[model samples]
Target: MNIKIGNNNKISSSTIANTVNGNMEFPKKSWYEKHPIIGGIIVSVIAGVILIFSFWADIVKFIEGVL
Candidate 1:
């Protein structure tokens, strides 16, 4: 990603953080506050997906033990 330059032709931290390409832009606090439920659901879904993928073998073993 290219560094973002300000109007003065100097790079600032904020400009770098908020790059035009959108990779560095993350959900800010105000975004969470505005859509708390949506944010919670999104976070929960991401966590659930990660957990399932990371522990698929353990999860299958646990299910087999329960059966």
Candidate 2:
């Protein structure tokens, strides 16, 4: 967002912050938002955990057979 403050000066939306009660209000970015890849990583980790839990008996049986 390009805002024309004057005849020549241009201000962008990224540089703007709302101030309240003598405090600057900045946009809060979430951890996942900052690192988008983390979302995929988290989903993959959850799927891996679910798979491991679901196949726990089979894994144990295979390990026992191998032993």
Considering every candidate listed, which one attains the maximal TM-score? 1
Model 2 residue 8 lDDT score: 73
Local error of candidate 2 at 56, Å? 8.9
Q: Give, for candidate 2, the lowest lDDT window spanning 10 residues.
A: 11-20
The 10-residue segment with the lowest total lDDT in model 1: 13-22
> Which candidate has the highest lDDT of all?
2
What candidate 1 gets wrong by more than 4 Å, as runs, is 1-29, 54-67
Tell me the tens digit of each residue's lDDT in model 1 across 1-67. Answer: 7655677667555533444554676666687898999999999999888887757888889999999
Candidate 1 residue pairs that clash: none
Instruction: List TM-scores for all candidates, in order.
Output: 0.38, 0.36
